[model samples]
Target: MVHKFAFENPHLKAEAVSAVVMTDLAQQYKVMSTPHLVLNGTRAVKGRLSEETLLAAILVEAG
Candidate 1:
């Protein structure tokens, strides 16, 4: 979804990392589940979220 969102939005950038390989990062963000999303380096949402919900999160974090 992050990839799709970034593809659709020109100004947005997104990246996917392997929790296994990026253990340090995963620990930094305290990732406890798959499909975890970190917005603006502070806000985060874990578990699957709809596109609209994800977009709203992005907007709120951007603000």
Candidate 2:
């Protein structure tokens, strides 16, 4: 999920928000240790999965 400190504290300066934004974006796009699947905006799953896992991910994302 994109967890920006500015979301909680709107007064945060652009520099601080940028720091968090860049970090989150990097993690989402990074090659190493990346999650196998992202469910919803927060949930993550790694490694091989079954139909149940797929269903859960779809449901979470749909919500």
Candidate 3:
């Protein structure tokens, strides 16, 4: 599912959307997160995943 949002704070919105996209993409690839980015359905990535980091994760998982 694709998700999009707009906000007065474009910076914050961009950041949030980036993180959501990463998590969603990760879910699509079945990265094996207990709660989808969470280590054990508890802790999750505290902030947005950088493009490089997201790409590497996707590539590693895809391979």
Candidate 4:
């Protein structure tokens, strides 16, 4: 759903950063907690989030 959302909105670029591969970057972002979502290099949401909640956040952020 996020991929399609991003695809439709070119301004939105969603990506995944591996904690294993991008350990340094993850630390820089302070990903000490689980279920983190970063938008435009800024911390957006953290902890368990539902699909609807996540989509709503993305939409709000995009606007």
Highest lDDT scorer: 1
What digit string (tens of lDDT, one per residue) describes model 4 on residues 1-63?
A: 566778888877878778668889878888876667886677468878777988888767767
- The 10 consecutive residues of candidate 4 with the worst lDDT sum are 34-43
The candidates, ranked best first by TM-score, are 1, 4, 2, 3
List lDDT for all candidates, in order. Answer: 0.88, 0.47, 0.39, 0.76
Summed backbone clashes in each candidate are 0, 0, 0, 0
- On TM-score, the candidate that comes out on top is 1
**Estimated TM-score for each candidate:** 0.89, 0.37, 0.29, 0.72
Q: Model 4: how large is the Cα RMSD against the reference?
A: 1.9
Predicted structure 2, TM vs. truth:
0.37
User: What stretches of model 4 exceed 4 Å from their correct place?
Assistant: none
Worst 10 residues of 2 by lDDT: 11-20
User: Could you give candidate 1's per-residue lDDT for residues 1-63 as a string of tens digits?
Assistant: 778889988989999999889999999999988988888788889988998998888888878
List clashing residue pairs in candidate 3. none
Ranking by lDDT: 1, 4, 2, 3
For model 2, the stretches where C-alpha displacement exceeds 4 angstroms are 1-26, 29-31, 60-63
